[model samples]
Target chain A: MDIGYAFLMCSMLGILASIAFSIAYLMGSDTRKIVKKANFAISTFTLLSFFTLLYYFLVRDFSVRYVFLYSDTHLPLVYTISAVWAGREGSLLLWLLYISIFIVLSTRRLDKLDKVTAFANIIMCTVAAFFNFLLLTSSNPFVRLGFHPPEGYGLNPLLRTPEMAIHPPAIFLGYAGMTVPFAFAIAATYYREEWVKRARNYLLVAWAFLGFGILLGAWWAYKTLGWGGYWGWDPVENSSLLPWLTASALLHGVIVEERKRGMKLLNYALAVVTFDLVILATFITRSGIISSVHAFARNKEAYAYMVLIVLSLLLGLVVYIKRKDFFEYDHSYRLRERLIQGSVLIFALSTVTVLVGTLTPLLMHASVTRGFYRHIEIPLGTALVVLLGVCVIAYRESMLRKSVLHSLVAGTLAGIVCFVLTKLSLASLGVGIFVFSLVGVIQGYSSRKIDLRRAGAIAAHLGLILLFIGVMGSWMYESSYTNINMGVGQSVHAGDYTLKLNGFREVNGNAKFDVVAYVSVYRDGKLVGVMHPKLIIYNLMRSDRIVASVDIISLPLEDIYIAMGGVTPQGVASFEFYVVPLVSFVWIGSLLIIAGGILAALQRREEKARKGVVDAEGEG
Target chain B: MKKLSILVGVVVIVFGIALAMSFKSELCPYVTVSYVVSKGEVRNVQVNGTIVPNSTKILPNNTLMFNLSDGKTEMRVIYHGILSHYQEGIPAVVVGSYYDGVFHAKEVLLKCPSKYKVAEENYSTSKVLSKG
Candidate 1:
């Protein structure tokens, strides 16, 4: 059956089995055999389905529509593997497979909490059914006719870049992976009060993964697209960023709630919204609902199918809320919960603002000034303001405790020294701001409060500070030379660096093309690095794309870089060089953010162990 | 807390002033072709030119050295991209600053000459490669 039916039938059977198992759970099923059997059945079915699809793509099954559209005989094996999720239908199948695998792995060690475990199964299976519906009715993987062709339309050459080749599935793994947590949240809402607590630890893990995944996507855009800028305000990018921003907020808010029994509703809502937004993001990206050149779900059938799926889920949510005691009085807080309430407000506002802005194109014709509610320049501006507020509250909040408030104060001064060494203007203020946040992270870590779970939170905040400083340095007051001509051994000055065009050579890569212009960069009359800016004409596209290869002479202080040369047919190549001050700090900051997530993951795990919670209540 | 509030105020004021000034001047780079099309800021542009042997830059080089048609209207351009044989000519829009001894180009968008458009049908990739 070419593995297509195997995957389809297995996923279908698994979904049906899960629905039956859910009914059995509610009805007091005998020995839990039905659910257990279904879990094994569904997981195995999903795994097999994935492999079959992979085989089709690998072997260049031109008969299969997806393979024909995305894969060719000349396509490398890795790209073929990535092609498993190159389009809407295939990606959903990939999502279903990944979540099913996640379900198996999560449930392996979990022994008790019968209701939560069942809830997890219920959520996954139901979501699987939605994907299956789309697969079968609208964008079916196995949809085909009789004629067999020898060749197929190859994957877009733009996507053939080494970074983009890996981007789709990795990001999908992140986006769809959120479903597990979302399902868990739904289950937690019904079964136990401790469910929220138990779910918090796993939430950090998911958040951490999602954050890194998003950053990887951004880095890929910077390197491959040759846009010379990372993080274009694209809807797809914003869709991913919105969840990350909220996840960051929740990662920190979880700590406060765990300790003080505050922000419970905020925590719950954040969980739901974060997961739902993952769905919303899916609708935006996959349904061809957003303005991007890359879209697979353009037909009415796919659109209607997606709308039906979304509407049904919404209806389920409304009915679920009405039926259950969603908010309990037991976890209630005092009226003086300004910080908690403010935090929630900030998170909701920021997440929604970004969300609305991300969908600005289809939703309405927004003015250029109000680009989108959740754009990087505006939405991130608001988020940064909120983060600054969080830092203040955290430092003051830490003072309430007796043990290490003094160390935080001392560390603040030490941080000032570090910030000054970078030679930034407004040095003292930057120093104070970074140091205060650094102290919060220090205090958060030192008093046995820091673990891997909370580590992500701490690191994220630290990364934010670094990002702010690095961006301000790189983007602000940056100088460059627009047009200049020189030949081999010729030199021209560009922002703190003199670039000497060493020579030109042909660079033959996997994607066959010609790359010329090999240049050397010198800052302050000293050789910094080599820059090979190539104007490549792709073999397949018969089109051109410039590749700027920047060698970062990285330091805490500055970095030297060069990008794709501007070369005409007459042998005149133009190169741009830069001695960017303190760009490495951006990467340093990202590391800190990931580190904070790790901390949060560890601590939240212990807390989960204590409270007996699960990960992501509404993942399904 | 009060000091933090004051800090916020200061930042807002600074941003407001900087923004006001930016609107009066060019804080961001315009598109390369736009600058070329606009002919903004004409000057004697110094550039590093790599010889493509017989590319866009080479055609001009050929015209200039052999005096194919005109004299003294030649310009030196520094460009970043691969070089392919194009002495036969193609439709292209070149934008740059024209000044003493050079038209230093910021951006060049080129299209290969279509064979179907030409008469006598002496067109193929092989012919071009053999010439190169």
Candidate 2:
């Protein structure tokens, strides 16, 4: 039998085995042994299916329709591997593969086998089966071609970068990781005792992966797209951001629920919303219901996916309504509690704003500008930052009126100082508030015993402060569009530097061609370095095959960027130069945020272990 | 705490609605050349149409002039920036205003048609053979 047929057969068998396991679990049988054996088999089959597709690409098998469409013989080995998830069918298959891996890993982490675990398993398996059915019917990556062409179409030239290769898989890992939390949220409705604790680690893992994936995507857009700006508030980008906002809120809500037994329904709602938004994001990107740069072609599979999303939402609502009485809590008047509540509310508001903006194009056929997002996010973000400062001080000092006043005075004074130093106008006030919060949180942690969770939260808040400062500084001070038409030996002065066009060279490759511009930079009449900005053209693609290569000179305070537009017939090369201040801090702050997440996860694991030991000691 | 929560909720909703209304004018509506011609000089709108092949010209003041069409009606567009290398017959989104029989475009975005659709014909084989 052919490899494609073999792969399809494997998926079909995996689905059958999963359904059998689900049935066995529902029948109150001993499901531990069945789950263990079935997980291994299902994982193996999924891995084989993925590798079978990869082998076809590696061997330049044009008889495979997917390979013929996305890969050419001239593609490098690295890109050939990257081509695995470059298209709609292949990406869905990749999603299936990642979901399968997550399922095996999560089931292995189950400490005991009970109805809760079994039900969670059943839920996950049902999701897996749904994906398998879609793969079998609508988006099979293993379909074959009756006739083979001599050469296959190459991958899109815009996606030829190294970052694009890893972007999709990282994002899919994030989307698949969210399923674990959704499963636990459903199980929480049944078993109320340990579900929150059980779901904590899974939720954190998903949040961290999603955050990291978004950072990578932003980086990819910066490096690959010649737009000079990282984010465009595009519909696809908004789709990703929607889930991220809800997931962040869920993270905060989980903490509140664990500490005070409040916001339980809120936490559950967030969990369901985050997962549903992930599905909605996939639908937006796949269904062609809204036009986006990232969407695939319109397909019939969208209707099936929409049906699944609506059913999941309705089911979650039913469960939540049925279990409403279990989640009631006493009202608390504590300042710290109020701050947490307010922050969650703010996050929800921002989520609604972005959701409305994103769906407007599809629902009303109207486009929301980047300014709308900015207007909503700026004031709310500033308030959230100020609230963080207040919360840290209040939490440390028992929420006293005097303590609150002290923190406010300190924050305002710091804001004025920042205003004088940075001269960032109104944004400097936000920077000041963030700095005060960072300092207060650090002080609060330092005075007490060094607790890992507390320290991680502080670090994460500090990272957010830095991110705000970076964003404010860069957005307010960026100067660009100093377009200069220069030939060899012609110099143009922009900002504090003089750019001289040194020369140009043509680079010919197997699949594409590049025109590299050699430009020398001088500051105060002293030579700094030569910058090479190129224009790359792929000969295969029919439209938008040309990409500008940006050269950047990094400094502590600012980055000097240059992009070559094109060379005229008269040997005059036009270039666009920009001086973007404090942009590196944005990237550095994101790394800190990711690091803090890792630290938080590790500390949570430690806390769980220590609690387990303490409980055992108490019993003894 | 109940009263406080209610107050905060009201403030957030009021603020959100107000901000959204204030910025409603900034939203750019996507239109076609036919719509622009029928509407007669709308401001701050977006136009999506295909560029007429061989109709692009570089003006002396670094502005680009091109004829855009929606397969039925055509309009002249003037963009005050360097035009990127674009496919001749594919759709491009121009964001600006229609004024005085010309579309004053502030931004021009080329659509990558080949990214979404399959290749119409296999020219790769012949190109590779020729190169070899």
RMSD of each: 9.4, 3.9
Which ranges of candidate 2 are over 4 A from the true structure?
A: A1-5, A109-111, A286-289, A292-298, A399-414, A421-423, A539-544, A607-620, B113-132
Chain B only, TM-score of each candidate: 0.33, 0.74
Candidate 2 lDDT, A1-620, residue by residue in tens: 66655765676576567667756876867667767667667777878888888999999888889998888888899999999988877777777787777777777754565667677777777777777788777787877798887777778766777877887787777787788888878876856544677667777777777777778777777665545566667777778778878888888887778788888888888888888898887767555566743242355676777777887788788877877787888766466777787788878988888887887766654576778888877777777777776766666445446655656677788888878886766766765676677766655555666677666677777777777777776676788864578988899898788999988777889877777889999999998789999877676644445667788888898877888766665577788887878888888877777677777778877987999999999999
DockQ of predicted candidate 2: 0.31
Model 1 segments more than 4 A misplaced: A105-113, A143-152, A158-162, A292-298, A301-343, A366-431, A447-451, A454-457, A477-485, A509-511, A541-555, A576-580, A602-620, B1-132
lDDT of 1 by residue, A1-620 (tens): 54667567776887788678766776676535666666677778877777777877777878888778776676777777777777887878877776776666555543552777676777767777777766666777765546777876766554665666666666666666666656676676566444455565456666666767676766766554443445655667777777776766666566556666555556666666677677667666666555422233345554654564476457447635763555544544432244444444455555655555555445442211122331334334434533453443344454534423543465457656755675554544444555555555455455655455445555666677777666555555345453456766778877667778877666566655555566777768888777666554444422222233434356557755555544443445544445555566766776677666667667744766656544444343
Fnat per model, in the order given? 0.00, 0.31
lDDT of 1: 0.56
Best candidate (score: DockQ): 2
TM-score, candidate 2, is 0.92
